[model samples]
Target: MKTSNRSCPPCRSWASRRTSRTRFSEFSPQEARNERLLTALTIDQALDARDAFAKALYSSLFAWLVARINHIVYKGSKRTSAISILDIFGFEDFKENSFEQLCINYANEHLQCYFNMHIFKLEQQEYAKEKIPWQNITYTDNQPIIHLLSKKPVGILHLLDDESNFPRATDFSFLEKCHYNHALNELYSRPRLNGPEFGVRHFAGQVWYNVEGFLDKNRDTLRTDVVDLLISSSIPVRYL
Candidate 1:
């Protein structure tokens, strides 16, 4: 297999070359308007955005490499049987779980659901297809919990994103919406006295998440000024 490399434009701007010290008040009205259009991220916010982008880039590359390797090995194989190993992060619990932990746990739930489908549902499917008589084994199916997390319009992630878009939104409001929309869901709950927190009964176990910075964490906006500055700087961080 051949990999292609692409060249990116070099950064040439002073803002991109040096640490940002520009004050918001110093910006012209037009610059301020552009900043608003880009969500006017602070220095810390810009660094966080870059770090997130780097992580996502590496993860995508890893997945692509795995798939490519599998394709290469399977293309000319005489034997049809093969064994594969996958390593994924386990469910996490902390003194204060946040959005990232929620995502990690949700991924674990999805993987568990996939395993159940293959072990239980698929086995029965194969038996029926082969006309073999076999007793059906009962197993817990986590479709409802998956739906609660991923269902369109009413999913927890969608609700969080909706709340993140509002300037006046707070963690409390986000929790309130979660409770209102998913009050009847067995997997979802909120403590009567706990401040701005919610619980999800994941397949692995129950985990409570603090919603203190959920809205801000979900707001992964990069200011246009920052982007332009980076693109114009002589820094090594070039976008291809």
Candidate 2:
């Protein structure tokens, strides 16, 4: 429940020095003109404040929804079992796919790897532990693809973020960096004669993602002006 007490510095200074008059007519024409100019200068700050307010409002709504669902599912006196189903979109490959598609496919790859581990590796281990004889089953492992996407300094996402920090970085530069680093990787490829795009040999299938806007989309930066405005707002939720 703690709230930020910060107010816009210029506004605060103007307010503190203003005469204690209840009506706007008491102010001189020059004073009214100055007030209008101050208002004009703070327009951007006001817009940022509104954006922060909207984000807080939606976050509170979703939190309430989650709380309600949790209460309904787990608050009963009697023990009961319930099934929760999650519906995720299938792997997407659009003509002009960008960073979002790459993320979705990466998530799908993780899920596939998890399924393989549980259905094959773990089950085999359990059988061996129980001393039950069974033939070995073969399955495709996606560790290489996952490694390519999440490796320490050379991973695609890492490279993208790194390049994004540079002032003059572009999507083409990001693509070139990916190509140079992952050129030796079998799971990564660049299409010959095709415009800025790369392909990942996922466990399920191969997906070529367009590199346009990759750096910009993955940047995920919030303007400092917005942060300052949110911190200076009168709304309590803006602090949170």
Candidate 3:
């Protein structure tokens, strides 16, 4: 098992870090409030840890519940195979920062990178096996999403690097040139009253949707040809 040595909010290490009385001795309102939240979280972590420890002592309690449920559903099936379905919430947007959030984000990123590398390799292998000309494959399969997100100098992260303009000025047109151009455009084109379909792109390692306002707002230097590609609803912006 590959384990992370990083701290987690609901884990033992974080609980130990806040095990001092001086942590709550602050008198200032903001400091007091922060301390209270941290203390509450620490207590929650301790209690959760205690409960987990207690589970081993009372293992039969869980076993009995599982047995009862299985008995009710199984109906004396000769061969029973238990399959666990795990659909962990892939990436999280949290209200507060914690070790769990960091771990989840790290795992999500790691999985994404791993999957991208595999996909790239798989595509290359399949192309090789079929003896397909490398240059002819649509850009969609060739460039995985991670390549875009992790691109240097002109990538999305690069454009959003300024703290003052964190979620502001961005140009996503470069994505059209991505190896996954068709997949990228399909995602960027649609509005999202849809469900989990949006995140499917993220699993592929690319940010599907981007802000056109941000792109248009600062397009002159970042992307000169953007004005020509601008498509509006009412007014037709002729593409020359």
Clash counts per candidate, in order, are: 6, 0, 7
**Tens-digit lDDT string for candidate 2 (8-124):** 111221121123211121221224644732122244434444454455556654555555466578866754333365756588877777888899988988888888999999999
The candidates, ranked best first by lDDT, are 1, 2, 3
Superior by TM-score: candidate 2 or candidate 3: 2
lDDT of 3 at 126: 86
Give the alpha carbon lDDT tens digit for every residue of 94-169 in model 1. Answer: 9899999988888888888989999999989999999999998999999888888879898998899899999999
Report every candidate's CA lDDT: 0.72, 0.69, 0.38
Per-candidate TM vs. native?
Answer: 0.71, 0.65, 0.28
The regions of model 3 sitting more than 4 angstroms off are 1-88, 134-240
lDDT of 3 by residue, 1-240 (tens): 544332111122112222232332221122464473332335533444344334432453344444545656776766344425465546754434232332355457567565555676677788899998886332234244444344565433343343224343223433333323334543233335532212224443333333333332322131111222222212221210
The lowest-lDDT stretch of 10 consecutive residues in candidate 3 is 7-16
* Stretches of model 1 off by over 4 angstroms after superposition: 1-16, 19-87
Per-model root-mean-square deviation over C-alphas: 6.5, 10.5, 21.4
Give me candidate 2's TM-score against the actual structure.
0.65
Total clashes in model 1, counting residue pairs 3 or more apart in sequence or in different chains = 6
